[model samples]
Target: MVLKCSPIQLAHSVLLTLGIIWLTPVWAAQEIRVGAAHFPPYTVRPERGADTGLLSKLLNALNQLQSDYRFVLVPSSIPRRVRDFERGRVDMMMFENPAWGWQELSYTAVDMGLEDAEVFVARQNPDRAQRYFDDLSGKRLALFSGYHYAFAGFNSAPKFLTNTFSATLTYSHESNLLMVLRGRADIALMTRSNLIDIQRYDPKVKSQIMVSERVDQVYRHYALLRLDAPIKSQEFAQMLNNLRDSGQLRAIFGPYQIDVVAM
Candidate 1:
């Protein structure tokens, strides 16, 4: 026996099949959880809502570039991020350095080919010159909590910073800068990228604050991947290279004064 379907019925069948194909991907996109810490100009976690920064922009661009992997931001703190990565809470960490307490962990480090530096910010005064920054012995330091500074021997202990350096630990870089501007603190250590951002938005900051030529640390950024991560370091590095070639990375990080070196 032979059967023939009507044109309307055949069209309906085709439409249904097309809908199924549209709804399903060729393969499930592997989920890659990236740690999102509150690093200004790199990543910012507001009092509420999702995080945003250069990291966010880079992730968004990576997502649009490929469908095999879905990169999602997982909230983590400066002190807790290493632990989170160790515990499998996050599979990847971007804009990190190996010397920043990661020596003990076994992970592949992919050099991000980016560079930034930490500099001192102080209120401008007629008498204060570059010499004022030469000695921090009696200076009141305003520092970000959980951040390691070369000046402090890379120790991020709050009590150590407070007692040894007479430092006040806070979470906001802006607050630290303001501390200097208001004479609440003698000096504030800020990232060059962040200071540039602040000066861009508030031009008065450039005139009111004197930035030291001395650097606390020069950040050579890297992306650390867990040993068992879905994506390998080579693969991730290639992805970054793709972004660099396509100019996406420059578009995202250039404005912040971050160097986009070829991989």
Candidate 2:
């Protein structure tokens, strides 16, 4: 039995079919909540309405590349991320280091094969040279609160940092840098990628500061996944590898001086 349909009916049927096909993935895709902290260059403006950072970009790329999962950002602070992860508020945390207080947690650590270092910054002066960064004694340090420092034996306690290193803890990297320029602080510790972004935005500020040749620590990035995460660490690593092979990672992080090592 062959029934001929009108042009309008045929068009309607085609449209309905297309809509169902498009909606299938969205319905079936698992939600993967990624923790986004106020980590600059990696995650900037996280508290703002819309996040603009490498993590956001990477998630966008991941979404576009696959339909099996839907990646979303769950805002968390540096100090609260660990709690959030344990509470299942977020399934994954990217740009993390295992040594940064994640050692005791039972989770899978996926090597991101990316690297960025922490460097010292100080105001430029005739008397100040690379040698100025060689010593930490008698120096007032400005650092981000809730960040573990290798110099302090990975201690992130505000009281410990203040008493042991004479540190001024703050949330703003810009403020830390300004403290150095204003001579309120002798040195400010910040990520190399962050410094690059700052210098790129404010070229004039670049000349006013001296970056240290000695790095305080090299940040070997990782993705820490909960044991019950929607996806396994191996799967996440493969997605990152795909991004690396397609040059997406390089395009996103290369300008910021974040190294994307081959997996």
* TM-score against native, each model: 0.90, 0.90
Weakest 10 consecutive residues of candidate 1 by summed lDDT: 45-54
Tens-place lDDT per residue, model 1, 1-263, is: 98999999999999999999999877899999999889998888822457677888989999998988999888888888999999999999999999888999999999998998999999999998998889999999999999989999999999999999999999999999989999999999999999998899899788898999998888899999999999999888888899999998888889988998866
Which lDDT tens digits does candidate 2 get at residues 101-172? Answer: 887788999998899999999999998779998889899999999998888899899999999889999998
RMSD of each: 3.3, 4.6
**lDDT (C-alpha, whole model) for all candidates:** 0.91, 0.92
| Candidate 1, residue 15: how far the Cα is off, in Å | 10
After superposition, which runs of candidate 1 have C-alpha atoms over 4 Å from their true positions? 1-23
Assess the local accuracy of residue 187 in candidate 1 as a C-alpha lDDT between 0 and 100: 97
